[model samples]
Target chain A: MSTVTLHKVCKTFGEGKLAVHALRDIDLEVGNGDFVCLSGPSGSGKTTLLNMIGGLDRPTSGEITVANQRVDQMDKGELAEIRLRNIGFVFQAYNLIPVLSARENVEFVMQLQGIPPEIRHQKSKEILAEVGLNGMEDRKPAELSGGQQQRVAVARALVSEPALILADEPTANLDSVTAEKLVELLRHLNDEHGITFVISTHDKMVMGHARRLLKMHDGKIIDDIQQR
Target chain B: MGIVFHLAWRNLWRNRRRTWLTAGAIAFSTILLVLWVPIQFGAYEIMINASLAVFPGHAQIQRPGYQEKPKIRNAIDNAETLAKKLRASNQFVGVATRAQGFALLSSGTRSYGAQVVGVEPVFESGTSSIPGLVKKGRYLSGIDAQEMVIGAALARNLKIKIGDEVTLIGGGKDGSVAAAILPVVGIFESGSNELDRFFSEIPLHTFQNIFSMGHSAHAIAIVGKTVEEQDSLLTALRQETKDRNDIVILGWEQLVPGLKEGIQVDKVSGFIFYGILIAVVVFSILNTFLMSVLERTREFGLMLALGSRPKRIAMLMMLESTLLTLMGLIIGMTIGSALVYWVHIVGFAYPGMEDLAQQYNMPGLSRLYPQLDLFNFLIGPGSIFIATNIVAWIPVLRIRKLEPVEAMRTI
Candidate 1:
């Protein structure tokens, strides 16, 4: 049931004279176990499109469906419910809470969902271990390195087992080697867990690991390539 | 709620110095309130007690117009019987009778008008402070002794001293010229200008013999455990002495008009002072919380984005404010109570108060004890706690308007 369908999505930033169109007319679909990368230059609507899919922002005029629920027409609280139950977001710079440790950060989403503590602990441990953070559960974000914190962020997104993980430039801060390792881990997670992933990034390394690539410029999608 | 508590408690210490300073403000207010209320009440109590100790006991029983007209004809003939009747009730602790009259006293070349009191020496100890306040000489010896204790101001005016012969001249009960020569035995200073200048005490039998009164008393002073019992004691006296048309009873409040009004003024001012203290502490707590919430805009947005209910975050802030205020309250009350207890044990006094009181002809201050009460202890902290939460809600409600998406964009 991990699915997303968008119909003629359009998003604008401001009203008439000073309006900045962040996303243009766009139609797209993603199925279960799809590793899709939205690759684009700066101000190219990739982040905006991902925000729409995750219900973090509303589109100006469009219809959006993720996990069989309408993301565009929902109210703020309803949108938050869908985002809480079905979608997980890994932001570019603000993914992990700075005050919480690795394990606490990973357990954040499960705690919000009213998950039992014992199960949340079990799932967070397993996910952190799966992301190569086996011995770093107690280290806070301030203590952890960029790559380790990003791993904790990824663990958080995957621990809830949401139908869709919307990550916006998750590897933009990590070095090339760490970034490659992260993309490879995401690929492995997609292969093994069958959760759909839609990542927006300008990093070529991220695009290289995707099975489908959608390139955008000036708020419009220019290329949609299914390589595999 | 547990997680919320954990986060809220930890958040308080994120700025430890600031948190403590805010709490310190509240603590300072609390300590002042706890200490000030008791001391104020104690001061009023000391004022009333000292003033009443000199002459007017807490309540008095006298013939109908003895205080207005101090003549031998206004004497109560059955004062002892009425005192015995009143003492058998549960209300009266001590009852002492006196025969008082006004006369001119002369010693060689000096003379002045004096108010003479004839009292039972042993029974006077329970009702008047004159027995305890005898300065240079001793009080009157017994019911049969021809001895007199005069006020210091009167002795100074007449140039009289211990064992000096002072002659009293006045009219007796039968309209004859009353005259007597008595040796001054003691001198008492009651610390009031008028009382020290015009009062004297002599043996009841000698005074009655000089005034030609046959076993008649002028006034009776009643003593009880506390002033709070005076009203009930008066009511009991009313019911007991209803048949005696010639006698009357009056409490000190009825005798002293301004004392109760002064106490009421102190109470009102105490409450207003405490209200200002609470307001200052509440504003300090609110200002601290508002700045804290404002500084965490991005962090709060992230929390909302992570699926925390807006109301829950507000409740968490409220919990933090409450905890902070309670911490201050505990510190303040502990220290305040300790200080109060220590002062109660050792007593509190000001330097040179005795001399100052004597110089001004006013009652001098001694060691004062405070009243420890429960309402100030509990309700004072309770009001501050509620006030802190109310002010803390102002900023958290503003935080509720934040959009997670916009918040994420904030640096």
Candidate 2:
């Protein structure tokens, strides 16, 4: 079964003569456990497409199905539920809540899901360790390095064990070594846990690690390539 | 929920100076209100007690229509028996029967019209502060003594002194001439110009015989231990006289309507000042929370994208304000209560207040003891708490309108 499907999705910002079409006629599908990468230059609608798939933005026209639920038709509350229960997000900025410690950041989603504290603690610890962030559980985002903060974000995303992960330029702020390590971590999680990933990136390292690559130009996908 | 609380608490301290400044404003306002409210109330209490003490005790029982139009014929029949019943109850500190009439008094050429109240000396001594306030000679000696205690102003106006004779002439209850030639045995200075200039007291038996009001008096004045006890005492008085339609029970507010109205007007002005104070603090709270919200736009967007609801975000912001308000209230009330308690023990008086009070016939306000009751203690801090949360909602409402995509782009 497919983890996500988009048919004729289009997104526009503003209105009238000033309108900017951010996405146009996007059609795609990612099967369960597939590792897919969306690569493009600036203004290529890669992030907008990722936002659409994650239920963060609504398409001006078209249908988006995530985990078999029609995302485009859901209300804001339903969209939040869909994001909470079925999808995880990793942002380009390593958007860990600045006030929360690393472990608390990892446990935020579980807490929102009303998971018990003991179990949440246990799961957060294991996930932080998997992301190679052990012994750094109590450091706030400000106290951590860029790569460490990114790992905490990764741990936060993967700890909830959602069916799909939408990453928007996850390696944008990392050095080559750290970016390679992050891509490897994402690949490991996708391969070991059978979690599907749809990553939007300009990094060759991240794109090379994906099993399939989709390239986009202005606001439309120009090529779909299978690497492995 | 616990995580949200933790997050909110940490967020509040992100700008330590701003948080402290906001909380300090709240604390300062709380302290001002906490201190001012009880003082105002204490002043009101003093005013009520002082006015009541001058003549109209905490309450009174008079014949129907006597309060509005007190005529010599509008007397409560067997008033002493009712006073005896009221005095028998432990609810009252003092109860005394009195007959009052408008009489023309003359002392060899100087003449003035005054209200003459005839009272039982011993009972009047217990019920009225006038007995203790007599500046010369003494209060009346007997229930039938041909003696009078006139006010200092009246004594001055009539050019009479103790041991001098004054003639009183008035219309009797039976339409005959009520006339008396009495010696002034005491002179009292009540401080009130009206009472001092136009009021005098004589023995009840003399008043009854001269006015032809046998077994009757104008009012039965009742004094309770404290002004707060007036309501319950008035209720009991009403219940005691429920079977009699000829008499009506009245509390101090009814007996002296102007005093109550004065207090009401003063309270409204006090509330207006307090409203301005609280509104200033509320705007400070609004500014603080709005800045916090604006600064954390990206963080909120990230949280919303991670599956937290807008309601949850709003609650988190509200929790921050609640925590801040709670901190301010705790500190403010603690310090405020301690200060008020100290003042209550030592008493508070403004400079030159005694002279000012004496000038206005309100000697009670000279030294005020602010009582920090539960209502006074909570009212100020409670208003701040409620207002802080209410004003906080203005900024928090912005969270509901935040689109994760748009908010993330805010910076």
Best candidate according to DockQ: 2
Give lDDT: candidate 2, residue A28: 92
DockQ values, each candidate:
0.41, 0.87
Instruction: Return the TM-score for candidate 1, rounded to 2 decimals.
Output: 0.82
Regions of candidate 2 where Cα sits further than 4 Å from its true position: B81-91, B235-246, B352-366
User: Any idea what lDDT model 2 has?
Assistant: 0.91
Tell me the tens digit of each residue's lDDT in model 1 across B144-228: 6988898888889999889999999988876777799999989887766688899988888787888887788888888888775
TM-score of chain A considered alone, across all candidate predictions? 0.97, 0.98
Q: Candidate 2: lDDT of B405? A: 89
Evaluate residue A156 in candidate 1 and report its C-alpha lDDT on the 0 to 100 scale: 85
lDDT of all predictions, in order shown? 0.83, 0.91
The sequence of per-residue lDDT tens digits that candidate 2 reaches over residues A145-175 is 9999998988888888899999999999999
